[model samples]
Target: MQPMALWKRVLILLVCLWGIAAAMPNLFYAKVEAHNDAVAAIEAAGGTATAEQEAARAEWPDFLPSALVNLGLDLRGGAHLLAEVQVEDVYKSRLDALWPEVRDAMRDLRDQVGAVRRAPSPDGILRVTISNPDGMTAALEAVRALGSSVVTLTGVGQSTLEVTAEGNDIVVQLSEAEKQATDDRTIQQSLEIIRRRVDEVGTREPTIQRQGEDRVLIQVPGIGSASELKALIGTTAKLTFNAVVSRTNDAGADPGPRNLILPSMNEDGVYYIVEATPVVSGEELVDAQPAFDQNNRPAVNFRFDTTGARKFGDYTAANIGAPFAIVLDNEVISAPVIQSHIPGGSGIITGSFSVEESTQLAVLLRAGALPAEMRFLEERTIGPELGADSIDAGRIAALVAMGAVGLFMIASYGLYGTFAVIALMVNMALIFGIMSAIGGTLTLPGIGGIVLTIGMAVDANVLVFERIREELRSQKNPFRAVEIGYERAMSAIVDANVTTMISAATLFILGAGPVRGFAVTLGIGVVTSVFTALLVTRAIIEIWFRISRPKSIVV
Candidate 1:
């Protein structure tokens, strides 16, 4: 066989070195992970680091590659939660918000419809009554004008609202198509908000994805507990600036027809009755940051977008000396009298809040409100101890498999078996290197795939060696026998690998979570083994033959 080209030999050497270097950080996983976290924290702190953070950062070499293969929830152990989004709540909120527009439309036609007032209605319907029955036609036409075209793929041609006259009352509700579209939008918004909240905490490899029509599955790796995860995401954080109606200490006070009662967040046994419609809602808030108020107390400073700024400016300008409540999730956080026309759209919220609470509230507000409420269906916390045990078991299994394979190969072919063993080690290193480069997560099944790869890595060598034995029996030269052996075994090796690659691809596409992790390692191992087992072993044998120049050899 012709000697391997110098370029090819150098390329092989470079690839092997790269794999080993990439895999080296994983051996000191905890130290490197701490270093990464410390670096991230320092960067977030604007280059200011605590003594502990500086110590952690110094533990690992700065010049070494730090990218590591992520460990999945099953291996890292964190929190899992399945939540069902209350899409109907958004339907009610959207419908309730329509009352202002409807009232405004009919008010412009007061000469025809007379005085208009909102009537008591259910969650998803808005009913308005007028004094004059003869104005029913005018009212219907005015309300219908408020309806807009539904902007969705399936509801493009449909109107967002259905307006009808029931006696002297003008009733309105979302159309069927609009309801579907709203449900989709609400679920999507909730998913994004939850993802933002989780990412804000710097947890790694979180799986925040929609499950079905209204369910979301959340798995956050490296979080403390399920309760902690739920606390972080479960808070609706719905903020509104409502007109203050009345205040009371009674637990069961009756609010007026268009007013609602909410308990005070700062005061015990206190309540406030606020108007249903908000002057501005949290949806228009563009930014919120934790800060100190005039009293040096923890507060959240907020800035509004252009639309919110105009509304806020007009309301504060008109309602000077009148108390307007800042409500969060139906609770009155504060009721402050408007001192002046708070013009710049920037305001501060002061309450009895600790620094930690204020910071978390700022994060939640910045992430934006969840369009609808979420009821958690399930909550589970996997302990890191269990993950440690799994990782240890996987490590031991991989080491045992490698050792057993190496011993078996060495006993079988003597010198060439040693070559196979060396190539097998390189194969494992290359698998890890590929995973690290791609930021792949490793699970228990992935470890199993790695162990299985140990066996498969030597299969090609076994086939070629058997073929070489056959050629030797027929009295061929050593070099010629080795050449024919690899050539004859190439077809079987290719067929086996082709089928395996197909299986790995299928699993990766169809499977979720840990199954996909298994597929990733198996697929990567298949490729690396081909390089190390068939090609690298051949290269090693070639160098051995060139050095010895043996004319006769024992198989």
Candidate 2:
């Protein structure tokens, strides 16, 4: 057979070499990971590295490729949690926001209605009592004007607020369609917030997605435990600045109608009664970082967006000499007097905190608050020892599979089988290299895929070899048999790999977590196996034949 073109052969060799180099980092994963972390820390800290970090950085050279395939939860043994979000909390928040608007709308008819007072109601419903029942019609009209169109597919023309009156009470609640849209938005936001919280700490690829209507599944690899994960991500971090009405020592003190009694976060006996409505919420925060206060105490520095900045500036200006509370998760952290109009949307949060606590608080603030609280329904922590055992088992399985396949190929087809084995090894390297390059995660099922691919990698070569045997039986010459064998087998090889590729793609699109991990490796293996069989193995045989020309050959 004629040799391949010079450029083509050169390209083939380069691809194999690239794959090997890209995958080499995995052989020393711990060292390379430490090196990467050290380099990242130095860069983040303005090119200053600790002595330990410098030592770690020396483990891997900067010029070498260091990308690695992330290990999945099951393979790496980490935290797994299934949590249910309290979606009803969003309904309460919506009602709280409507209070000011509704109150203003009702105030227009104050002569007829007399007085407007918010009365305690169920979580989603808003009840306001009017002094005169005769103004019910005007009250309803006023609230209805506040209704805006819901911007969801199903609620195209529906109003967001539903207003109705019963006796002297004017009741307001979210419309049914609006509630549905709110629930979906809340869940999606929760999912994104959790993912951000997980990714903020630089943990490897985490699986965090919505499951049922109110549930979310979280699997974070390389974490300490499920409880640790819950602590890291489950905190709502609901930061807000509120108008403090008064201070009290009673735990169950009544804060009148429009105020809430919250205990102090640091002081044991102190509590503050703050307005139910927050002047500026955490959602308006644009950025947060760990910092040190003027006293060199650990603190969190926060910057707000334009709208929040304006609101904060206005509130501080109007409420000078009055105390406002910084509340986080319903606990008053500080109630400092507004000394002056603090502008520019930037401030510092100082409290009794360790360096680690300040850093973690900053991360949470930057990631944003969960729209609602999460209650963990299930939690599991896989230990490192268990993960190491799993890795060993998977490694043994792959090696046994590869050795068995190699033996069978050699026994079945003799000399040509050795070339197939070499190609198969290259195909395996290419799979790892591509996965590492793409930052794919390897799960337990992904190990199965690799083993399965090791067994199937030689199938294309087997077909070509069998076809050559057929050609020899038909009185063809050796070189002609080799050429025709490849030509005839090409259609079958393409068809087989194409079908497998479709299946892998379907799984990748429809599946989640471990299933997607499996699909990723399988899909990559299919392409690499095809390349090594059609080109790498064939090239080896062609070069061999060129060097030692034989008249007759046995298959």
Which predicted model would earn the best TM-score?
A: 2
lDDT by residue (tens digit), candidate 1, 1-555: 767889999999999999999998999999999999999989978999999999999989989988788987878899999999999898798878888888889878899988899888899998999999898998898888888899988888899889898988888999999998888888889989999999887775687888889999999887899999999999999999999988999878889777899999999999999998899999999999999998899999999999999999999999999999999989999999999999988999999999999999999999999998899999999999899999999999999999999999889888989999999988988998889989888988999889988999899889988999999999999989999998999889888988999999999998877788889999998899888967899899999998999998765
TM match of model 2 to true structure: 0.94
Measured on C-alpha atoms, candidate 1 has an lDDT of: 0.91
TM-score of each: 0.85, 0.94
- The per-prediction CA RMSD against the true structure, in angstroms, equals 3.6, 2.1
Question: Model 1 segments beyond 4 Å from truth?
Answer: 1-8, 38-59, 108-112, 134-138, 148-157, 245-251, 292-297, 313-324, 335-344, 411-414, 459-506, 552-555
lDDT of each: 0.91, 0.92
RMSD over all Cα atoms, model 2: 2.1
- Model 1, position 498: C-alpha lDDT score: 82
